[model samples]
Target chain A: MTENGFDTSCGASSGTRILVIEDEDTITEFLKTGLKYEGYQVTIAKDGVTGVDCAREMEPDLIILDIMLPDKDGFEVCRRIRRRDSDVPILMLTAKKEISDKVKGLDVGADDYLTKPFSFEELLARIRALLRRSGRAVDSTELRVVDIVLNTETREVYKGGKKVSLTPTEFSLLELFMRHPRRVFTRETLLNRIWGYDYAGDTNIVDVHISHLRDKIGDKPPCLIRTHYGVGYAFYPGEGK
Target chain B: MWKKLSLRTRLTILYAGLLALLLTILGVTFFIDTRNLLIENTASHIRATAKPIIEHWLYGENLSSQAIEGTKKKPDSKYLKKISRQLARDLTSRNVVAIVLDKNGKVIANGKVLEEEPAPVSPNPFYYRRAFSGENEVTYILSTDNKNVLVLLIPLRSAPGSDHVLGVVQLSSPLTPVERILYRHGLTLAVGTLITLILGTALGLLLISSALSELRHMIATCQSITEGRMDQRVHLPQRSDEVGQLAQAFNRMVERLEASFSAQRRFVASAAHELRTPLTALRGSLEVLMRGAQDDPATVAHLCHGMYREVLRLSKLCEELLDLAKLEISENVQKEKVVLKEFVNEFEEQARVLSQEREISILEGPSVSLKADPNMLKQILFDLLQNALQHTGRNGRIALGWKLGDNGVDIWVEDNGHGILAEDLPHIFEPFYQGKKVSECGEHHKGSGLGLTLVKAMVEAHGGSIEVRSEVNRGTTFLIKLPFE
Candidate 1:
């Protein structure tokens, strides 16, 4: 899919397509707007019936399904999709606690499932992992911004030859900054790019995650990942420790 | 101890014991009657045999001359001794003992076929004294040999039918034949009573077992039900006996329990489903605002307002949930004296505000006064009218009416609009039940699905009932009956 003439976050087209089958209008709108911003072509089906029909026709790279629907449930839709295309990764969304476990018990072969009230960042991480596992995401594997090295494939971040642990949101924020080193991003852009419709009343989730990332990789004095005054953040590699 | 016994055992004992008592009483009476009859027959037979001997031989001898000749002519004792031995010898074949007493109350002679020792006749026995008075004396004694002996005395007359001062003749006959008959009769009575008791006991056990077999089957069915087989039934074929009725009642109880339990389970599932949708919307709208929409005032305002609506819906659902919990625990209804016309007038004021574009009217009725909880009654009207407004088209005609009935006051709400589907009418009051498709009803028409459920609960809490009538595309009506205290 890299044949497209658009530059994605992966430095090429990386034209990955995703299908979201959900009955809720608000959720569908949120997912569509955020996913399009992430450089992924998104298709929305308002119900399980149309979703099954779309799966047969378009053959998307990944499928995000909601467990409860008007005509058919998420499990039935997953089974119908798997009947034709077995390898397409399906991530189910369940509103109920018991039905989340039933995603596997029903043996519909869902690749993974997310309970409702999940943050958009977690959803994005799961989607990327599924796309990468299915060999649909052609993005670069390893990144190096000066002395720090990060592997997107293994999800390992190393600073000065020492392993550094990061939360999924922190890792995504770091990946975006390192991908475009020396370029600044605004708070809004940072929030939208990494968090992707992640809900919070605080409005400073990005700053919190950034500081935590800085702390873990020993960039607490803010020299490596530098912040511009009214802008957002940029990766400036140095012996800031 | 009797109370501790099984029903079958008690019934059998009562049945057999009664029979045994009746048979014993009948047996004793029959034995006494037959013994007396045998004794009377033996006495008559002895008198029949003795009369001829006393008149012919004993009377014609020495005692005949003393008749018409008075007491001064006491028959010679020497003459009495001669005839008495022959008289005793004459009765040897009759199993009789003979004795002769002279007019002076002296025993002159007594002989043969009697006790092993010559009989110990008193010198002046009561029979000898009764004989001197010219009266015949009769009595019975148990002989030394254990036989019944009847004693007979006759006044020896000078002529036929003559009362005279003459010597007396006495005869004692053993009653072995009557005793033999009595023994045979008693044996038959005893054996007959024993056989009847044995047969009655066996038959009583059979009847008792047959009568209680259905009850035993019921016990077995109850055990199976306790083991959680809700579908188990006694399966009796319309027997109208007590056990049959019990089985029917038991089956009905289990069915109701199973139905209500499944209803509870469905309510929980649908409650979770209903709650999730609003929460999802709230989350989605908030996320959209926090992510990027905050920069644009228009989008920020739109998302915030949408989030508010979602929050309202969630809070409304939570309130209904709490009301349902309260309905289960609160049996004490707040009592207030209410007049129907006044109550409806106050309700119609609220109803008009709620009707919006719909046409609302009130039907005039009697001012029926009753004791009830006012807030709960108001909530009932609130929910019912709200339900009606949601299902009806714009400008739909709505009517509220009341009737004072003999039992209670009936308040009804009728709406002329898109009525409930016939299939959904039965479940419309069930918790979280959706009457029609939400899409057809419009976005705002989507309900928390607990309105009618709450209405019904409140109605029941007032010691009242609610019923609904609907036609698919014509109209719907809900009737509430609040009984007078």
Candidate 2:
């Protein structure tokens, strides 16, 4: 997004919850930062016991699991989680290239597996694919919220029967807000959703995207996205003139 | 050439050959003795049959002498012929032929043997002339009839115990009956010997093969083991022979080989697993940094720090792997005399420096002397203490001491902290296995996960054993036993 040539909204990627269960601190941190940058909500659990509990509580769209955990292994955790929720997609991370390990992980209800040292791009692609395939993401071809119509497939927007031009980032940001109308999208959420959330710098970039999106959609005078000052941003459908 | 053959083949041949030789000698001895006994029985029967005939011939000779010339018998063929015919008729029987020869070695009467049984040729003049000198002679001759003859020459007297001119009574037995009996007996002896040899050899081969079967099974087991089935065993039934002893030794050797092979396999697996973790981290960090994370100063710093930590962990793993390999190559340790009390006192001081806030003390125990490398012992104690420090809280107490046991001294480390879970207690000593975290404050205390493994290897290298006992939420203790040297 924003000339990074990456779109966070494939269908609807914003606020897509993902849970990662891993014991390695560095790997877990790397996954958390990278997945967040790609605009997916990430929850981490350090051990299998906590991981199972979190999988039940988070009700995530996808689960990233590691096999080697301090208390219990990922297989045991996977089985326990699968017993409760059979629909959630589980992606396991393994350290061994042994076929038995991969087959066992799959046998225990893991949807897919990745070896360690995986590139973040591949991980993001896999997550997006899993989310789309699971039918968790909003997969409608077009969305209409208060006379603001967004075509997710053609990447076009129309306000009150008049087509409006928008950059890719502005288009993605609009698609996310329209997918879930009137839901609060924080600045961090906007930055994470639109600008790919790599830097923790000033979040004023989210404002710039919002203003640009508002301008392109013919909204003004405190309209479209309302600010929760000292917090983040949200889309308001009826309040926008 | 003999040595080139297999043991089974050589032993079979040797035992079979010995048995054959023994049976042949026995059969030959028995055959010869039986032939001699049969011949002697035939000769004695001829002598008994001739006894009454000789008496009858003497009575006829006395009557003839009384009727003609008044016992002045000399060179009278006609007078001797009638007496000879009478004597031949009485002595002739089955398998026995009688021939009466005059004093001049002429056969006077053949008892119809010449017509029916083909009598022996005329007696030898020198043999019968010697019989005329009152000597009874026995001889074997090949007669003209192509049969063997046993001849007993008896000189006829005018009366009992009288020295008078008479004729010679030759009691000749055709040895065809004895010869046929001997021939059949010889055939029996030969056939019996052959059968005995064949059966003995066969039985010997069977016995030898049965004895060697265990060895063959062991050989097959060896081949299977070479093919990577380390669990193959002979499993022979119990026996008290050499083969049984060898099987026992072979099974024991295989057990040791299997144990070592599995241990080696485990070591390689553990090394690969351990090395992969840090390497995975390093590669992941470098890859992240290379892919635009370097543009952010905070992310770059964080990734660089992580990479450094992983690099350090890799080097530590390398060092520990080297120690493990060295332990495998040379279990030979540099043993030195060490007094337990003094060693503990100095070691406790070093352990106290690892954590300044925790309570670590020593229990009073037996002051014993042992032969162990002090540096390795110190390293073992240091590793255990670090493990204890990582598991215990600030005010938790750890007691380290030694105690005299039945045959060895037991060194112990006990902590009054959160104990291990039952499931995890078994795998704590395994390399690269991380147990459940029990200490609230030990989160920052990092470990290589090879500490307990190294401690065990070092202790076992010194011919000692290490054992652990734990209960969840109560406490845990590690005991090491070093036998007195």
Candidate 3:
């Protein structure tokens, strides 16, 4: 594990190609520098027109598209890319902080969306989540963080080499956290990812499920699922090397 | 001073003055006519007495030849006394005096001879000469004593239808009695006119006040409005008079003013509330950063990122506020013929761009042309399309097109997407009012919340209307109808 949260022990160590279609020079530079530093190959396109062209030419494993572009917008670029390559993951970046933008981006075949002015860490986490969902980054169906293990195929959980049973929702919640360990997940995000996008129930359900999962898994003094007060929850492995 | 008087007062005065003028004219004519009748009666009575005396003297109806012959000549003093005694019986009427004049201009008889100690002086010599012209003479004179006098002179002939002049007879009567009667009647008429004038003024004042009450009520309403009670209205009467119509118009004007004021207040309140959201976010992010989050690179980056997002939201809000202001102030629409085919063509590229992953296409209708403010119409279409894109899922079918209707053209952007709730449909066009579900979301449906509001305003500005139909999870369709110009 590196500072950029790249686990070298993972099967695929390098050459995870990412295409970024962004009009802003600084953002393009930031994405390129950061993604490359995280041990992935990155390609950049300046406008929506060229973005669509490069997407077809590069056939990257993942795409980071800006919603606003000169010739065509990110939605258009995403739509064009999805037409030929339905399996490739697309993460939309929009300057607008509107859910409508996110919904539109996802409706147009984007895997997920991150609003502009996003932190590099969150951007990286979303990108990794998208790639993992597409089954391109995490080659194995199993995810491991320290002593905790989650098998996607078997839907099984293990703590300290012992089997731990989990409800479907708890399993999905744990699997989401294990997929992007050390990345923060707000209660809302967890609910949306685990329950469904249209869930209208109380957020306390998430807290209840989390505590239940922790108890069932038998976390030690330093709990695996760390609660970040005033924020959300994150799966933080121990600081020991 | 008259001009300073109120309308009611002026109207009353006008009515009273007109009545007084009519009454004065009537009274003057009646008084003059009655006075003339009275004076004529007095003159004719004096003449009637003189005729009998003159005929008796001229024809010597009951006198011997010596007496008749003496009366016929200038009437000697002894004979004049005899004639005077004969004429004295007819002089008993009020203010009557009588005299007899001979052909030789000598006084022969006086009707009031009984009262004279020295045979009453003969009448003036001019009376005998004026009366000897073969006809009778009558005159009215004001005597030296300020008495109105009627004088009658008769020229007597010995036989009827004879032109020969005979001795003249004279009669005089004072008109003081007739003058008194006329004065009494005139005084009564004057008093009556004055009473009528007073009553007329009172009635006029009543009428004027009642008529102007409506005006006064309107003024009171105006005062109330001036004091910021814009909802006040003038009390209206059932009669549709000028004042009643004015009251109704005034009420309508006040209603409009109140509605506009409320709208402006609502806009300000909504703007403040919307601004507070972004301001709170910015404050929270800065506070977190100041509380040592800056020491941690990841936390610093996240906080800065949130602050930047809040700033962008504030900027977008400002833009929307400016747009709303512009819409409010833009009173006139500049219209041009926009072909539906051409308009729909522009959306092709935009649709392709937005529909990249989704199956979005334009179903161009017939070549229908309509008048619209092109810029505003374009904005309206963009807003509707953006909304459709927001709800539709990947691979969902969305269509942008127009169809010719009976009256005009109907443009629509439809999608097989999550439709709006029934409760939110009515309020979607209100500024700062996001749908209930969107507002409750973890990541609020990012919007200035003025998109639908702008769309509605722009559509109306182009003299068009927008309508929506939707079913839960099935689809939503927005239709804009524009009349042909």
User: How many residue pairs clash in each candidate at the backbone level?
Assistant: 0, 2, 7
What's the ranking of the predictions by lDDT, best on top?
A: 2, 1, 3
Query: Per-residue CA lDDT of candidate 3, range B1-485, in tens?
Result: 99999988888888888888898899899888888888777777667666666566545644455554434443343454466546654543446666666677666666664453222333655655767767665454545456556666676554555666556666666666777888888889889989988888888888788878878878887988999988788877587888778788888888999988987786776787667545644543443343224435775576567668777888989998998888889745788888878877885777678666878778878887888877778778778877877777766788888888768888888999878889888888888775645521122256777998889888887667889998778888999888887
lDDT of 1 by residue, B1-485 (tens): 98999999999999999999999999998888887777666667666776787665655544565445555433344545667677655644446566766777666667565455234333336666776677754555556556555566666664456676557766666566667887888898889999999999999999789778878888898899889887788788877877678878988998899898788888888898888877777766666555545555676676666677778888989988988988877765798998878888999998999898899999977878989998888888988998888878887899999998659998999998778878888998899886544434443466788999989988898888999999867889999999986
TM-score, chain B, predicted structure 3 = 0.68
lDDT of 2 by residue, B1-485 (tens): 99999888899889878887888789888888987788778778778778877775566445555455555544354556767776787777755677887766777788655456546456777777778888754555545556677777777776667677588877776777888988898898888888888888788888888988877888899899899999998887888788989989888999998887887777687678777777767766655554335546798788778778888888988998888778768975789999998999998888888868888889969789898999999988888887877787878788898889768789999887788888888888877776665334537555767889889999998889999998866778999998876
**Docking quality tier of model 1:** acceptable
lDDT of all the models against the reference? 0.75, 0.77, 0.71
Off by over 4 Å in 1: A1-18, A25-60, A67-226, A230-241, B1-26, B48-239, B245-273, B279-307, B335-337, B366-371, B403-406
On DockQ, who's better, 2 or 3? 2
Candidate 1 per-residue lDDT over residues A1-241, each given as its tens digit: 2332112334212467789999777677667765654567889998778999998888899999998776667777888899999999999888777854664624888998877777766787788778768877755577666556788879999988999988888888888776554556668767666655444435477788888888887776658789887667777643442
lDDT of 1 at B236: 84
The DockQ figures for the candidates are 0.28, 0.17, 0.02
DockQ-sorted candidate list, best first = 1, 2, 3
Model 1's DockQ score: 0.28
Candidate 3 local lDDT, residue B72: 46
